[model samples]
Target: MSANFKVLTEDSQFQSELSEAGGRLVVADFTSARCGPCQRIAPLFEEMANKFPTAVFLKIDVNQCTSAAASQGVSATPTFIFYRNKTKLDTLQGADPETLEARIRQHYGDGEGEEIEDSGVPGHIDLIPMINKAGCECLNESDDHPFIQALTSAGGYLESDTDEQLILYLSFNQAVKLHSMKVKGPAENGPKDMKLFINQPHTIDFDSAESANAVQEIALTAKDLEGELIPLKYVKLQNVMNLTVFVKNNQNDSETTQISYIQIIGSPVQTTKMSDFKRVTGKKGESH
Candidate 1:
C-alpha cells in the first residue's frame, strides 16, 4: 500500500524497478502469500526500507509471479536477493533479521551513520581476518576454488572439488569468545552437518575429524542457512586461540559441497589488565 515497499503482481514492473535501481542497492524479497516467515519478516524489511532511503526495496509474491522468482533462482519463499549496480550480490533464504540488518549496514554506510543499538550485550564482530592471518588450510583444497575468495570476496566462495567434506584449521592471534555464526550458499550444496573444535593445535585430517570429539556439533536445515545467527557455546569458546570446523555433508548429499559465506561473530577475550595504564589529564581550560 505504501511506496516504501512496492508489491508487484507481475514481472514487467519488477524488471522496470530493477532497471531504475541502476547502481544503487536493491533488495528484493521473493515471498509467498502463505508463508508465515514471510509475514514475520515483512515489518522488519519495511523498517529497513524506511531507514535506508537510498536503497530500493520490493516485495514480490512468488506465487503470483512464478517466472520472476525463477529468473532470480529463488526456489523458496522469503528469499532475499541483494543487488548492486543491477547485479546480484547475495541471497538470503529466510527471515534472518540479524544478518539482513548487517548486510544492509555493510553496504549502506561506512560506519559514519548513526549506529543501531543492539541488546545490552554488544553485537559480535567478524573474526575471519584473525583466522586467516593465524593461518588456515582446508581439506581437499583446490586452486580454482581457493579459500581466500570465500573469506574475502562478497560473491566468491570455497567449494570442495572432490567430496562433501571440508575441514578447516584456524588459529587466532588472541583469544576470543565465539558467539553466533551465519552460513549461506546454494541450497543443495550448502552444509547440512557441521562440527566445531576449540583450541586445536594442528591441522585436523578427515580421519581425525571423524574420530575426535567436537566441542559442538550442529545439524543445519534450510532455515539455518538463511542468514540466521547460530549461537555457539559461549562458555566453551572462551579463550579460544585456535578452532576447527568440519562440514560433514550437504542437505541433498551432493557430490561437491560449496560455501559462499561463513561468518563468525564474537569479541576478543580481554587478557590485559586495564588498571596498568595510569590516567594523564590536563586542566579543563588549560591550553597545551
Candidate 2:
C-alpha cells in the first residue's frame, strides 16, 4: 500500500475518514482476504493512490469491518465506491483493472479531470468588476449584512431581514455570456431552490419572481454551497445585461438565508456598431 492508502478496520474509522475528506474525492475499496480478484487489483489500486495524491484512497476488509461494508451496501467483494462531499457518486462491482482506472480518471484525472461538464464556451472570467453597483439591490436583506459586502468584500456576508427568501437584482456594464455561478455560505442557511432571470427591466419582487417564468431554477445541495461553481443554462444566458437571483428558500428551511460569497463567471460580449462600418466610395472610374 502507498502512503496515501489506508486500511480501515473499524466502522468508526471509516466514518472518520469520510468526514475528514471534506470536498475531496474518496475512493473506497471493499474487499475480502479470500477474494482472488481483490488480490489481483490491489497493486493497481495502490498505484492509483500514489498517482492521485489529492484524492483519498481507502481499503475496507469486509470480513474485518462487516458493519462498514453493510452500511455502504457492499454485499459483493471487490466493490469500489466513489464519494465526494459526503455524497455517493458511483459504485463499481468486480475488479476489472480497466474499469477501475477509468472510474478514477473520470473523477480525478492526471491533469484534465473536472467535475463540471465542458460547456464549450470559452473565455470565462470573473464578472464582478463589470457589475453596475448603483443598479444592484437586494430586497429583504439586513442592513448590517448588506449585499455589497457579500458581493465585493471577502469574509463579508448578507443575511435575510424578514424571512428565508431574498431577491437580488444586478445589472452589468456590458452584456455577458454567463457560464456559471458560485454561492458560498453555511450549509444550513445557504440559498436553495434558486430562480434565475435575465434582462429584467425592473427589480423583481417575491410574488412576481415566483409567478414569472425563470430562465433557470436550481435546488442547491450542501456540496454546491461549498463554493462549487454551479453551471447556468448557456442558451438562456447568452446575451444577459442584467441578472436577478431569487432565493426561494434555504437548506434545512432556516428562518433566514445567508450568503457569504457570490461569484459570476462568464465572458463579456462585444456587440457590433453601425458606426464602425465605413461606406467605401467607388474609385473615380471613367465608366460606371
The residue-by-residue lDDT of candidate 1 on 110-227, one tens digit each, is 3222222121224345555345342777877566886665654356788887888988776766577788777877888888999999887688789999888999998888888776
- Tens digits of per-residue lDDT for model 2, 1-288: 676689888878988997687646789998877888888988888889888877889998877876677667666768888765454556888889889987776555223222322223243555665577778999999989989877753468999998999999988876777889888889988998999999998998899999998999998998999888799998878889999999999998989999997888775564222234343233211111
Candidate 1 accuracy as lDDT = 0.70
List the candidate 1 regions with Cα displacement exceeding 4 Å.
Answer: 1-121, 271-288
Worst 10 residues of 1 by lDDT: 279-288
Off by over 4 Å in 2: 1-122, 271-288
Models 1 onward score TM values of 0.53, 0.52
Instruction: Mark the 10 consecutive residues where model 2 has the least summed lDDT.
Output: 279-288
